[model samples]
Target: MTNSKVGHRIEELTTPAFLLDLVKVKSNCQGMLETCKAMGVSLRAQTKTHKTVEGAVLQTGGSRKGIVTSTIDECEFYADHGFDDILYGYPLIAHHMPRISALTRRLEKFHVMVDSKLAVETLIASQPPTGKTWSVFLKVDCGNNRAGVWWEDEESIILAHQLGSYSSLITFRGLYVHCGNSYYAKTDVEVEKVRDENIERLLNFVDRVKERGVTCETIGIGSTPSCKKPSDNMKKLDELHPGNYVFLDVQQSTLGSCIVDEIACRVATRIIGHYPKRNQMLIDCGFTGLTKQGEGMLVTGYGIIRDNPNLKICNMTQEIGYIEPLKGKLDFEKYPVGSLLFIFPWHSCATAAMHSVYYVIEEDKVVAEWKPTRGW
Candidate 1:
């Protein structure tokens, strides 16, 4: 963002807009890429967070492929734009296998998740071309209790080895685990422990499988909170996928992942009205635009106001926000009506996904703008 361009864009645009600092965005992107380089693993970033092609490109380093999507529509959109090697990363519902088979036809390598006999049977019945390999990974439950097989369950253990039988069409990729508990870590020290423990358990699972000559071809592990604090533990995995680092949100900040300066995206709103008597103010930005996420009883608001830390967006209605001024604080002389303010969301990915386009800023100025790809 430049000084002149900031003025130009401010004049050209209306309030309640999405602002993106490319400088900060680039830095955030580079930090995660560097972490992957140091870990000696392939980075197949999860795109469910950003849900944008521009956001995806910034994190791609040089390659425009080998990414993960959360939805079938997202997979089709990315593949249409020449992005191959996509892993849906979610559970394989039996009814969705037909659509999944169609996606396999569009990519060089398409990976799916399998954790049940029903899912496996449906996948076998709906197979794609023999020329392009269809790969499947068993989602391991590393004590997350999520949608995955227990690491030591006899059924899961037997299924892991049985996958080798579909040698002609479906190939066993490896064990896939999402260490969701990593987010519970309070400090960087604790976060590193979570990372190490996740790697230890998953690698132990790998060793357990290798005992039967059923070596995992791809060992995958990730969680944004886990990757935020890098560790030597990552060396055990073949690939790492972390998505939310592209836009550092307040949630990441609360988790101690990154600071406000590292935050690349924000919501720009104007002070529409003031209530000096009630010690509050109103802004045009609301849940419809800013996204109702990353805030709760503790946060107690939609987002954090960058200029005023003590001020609380305590109350929010359809088209207004009540800015609770600190006790006995009534100083709207400095903040007047129509003043543009920046807000950092609790979840960067969720907030940014709702935005239509982003104004690229540099040095506190808007210099460029980029539209984001939105939808499932």
Candidate 2:
């Protein structure tokens, strides 16, 4: 039934094709499932990384099928596809109220994160579907100090109380935090240290809210680097909300979140230009195919040329990759003009965001054509 579709995907495949290994992708999905189930924690895998119904279906294990989305566009895409529980992971922004309100109606259980008084106050002002209860989670900043509120902050505890007061305006589901700082840890021991600090900080807040007689729903934490090592500390929270696990990339692999074998997606490109004199080759894949964003300390190239790890395709313009040799000088003879090459991106999110569609590859052949729901 899908042979022609696969064939079409291969034929129309131009330069910089997104190649997804179905087997690896599914394995990564089930691994996340096992980690969540074993921890006795609710696993709501974030779908923003792979904003497609096909991707969501793979993550639905043991009837717990909820997924997290960073943008309202993803929520809408998945909702129409019949995905019920959608958590917009980002703090609800000011101008996006209309969509949030509309999406709430479409979803069976729609939740958004909030931390600042301004955001909470704005959400209240938006008056999104008063008849329909909109769930909210307080964003806790354990250590990363990004969008979340400090766990012990009096202002945060007070807002939780205020939001809980209005049953009509909002349903205070729980407090959520993302241990984003774990990415900086050089070792598992260091990551575990961050984990303990994060959990302790969040638990302290839970204790404070409970003292105020405020009913707390769930305690949540996310981030691929932190939750990737579930045995270390992810289960400490009631739920884990790691997204990049869907399509593990170079960044996650280096962090030990995933193995090189677990990387589910890659960019397929053809060698076009070879500068034998300068010891540089060029692939049709460029910054558009890869990401401008690189990984930590190591000069994480735009993306990795997986076939040859030693040879880094370091520099990239819009349409070309300045490929260099890992060993000796000129090796244009090794790679023919039409040879297909695979590239592992610096970050999965960046690569996924730019591409319109991804081709599921199996046994070195194209299989399923999955279209990502892009924007916001």
lDDT string for model 2 (63-155, tens) is 435788888888888878877878888887788788888888766799888878898888778766746876898888988978888876798
TM-scores for every predicted model: 0.92, 0.93
Best by lDDT: 2
Candidate 2 — what's its lDDT? 0.80
What's the lDDT for all of these models? 0.77, 0.80
lDDT, candidate 1, 1-376, per-residue tens: 6423344555345767788888888888888888889989888888877666776777787577888887877788778777788888888987777778788876788899887777777666765765765688888887677778887777777778777777776788998888787777677777777778778888888888887678799997888888887777677778888888888788777778888778888888888888877787888888766777755623447788887777777766766777876556858887799887788888777776667667777656677766656654
Superposition error at 220 for model 2 (Å): 0.8
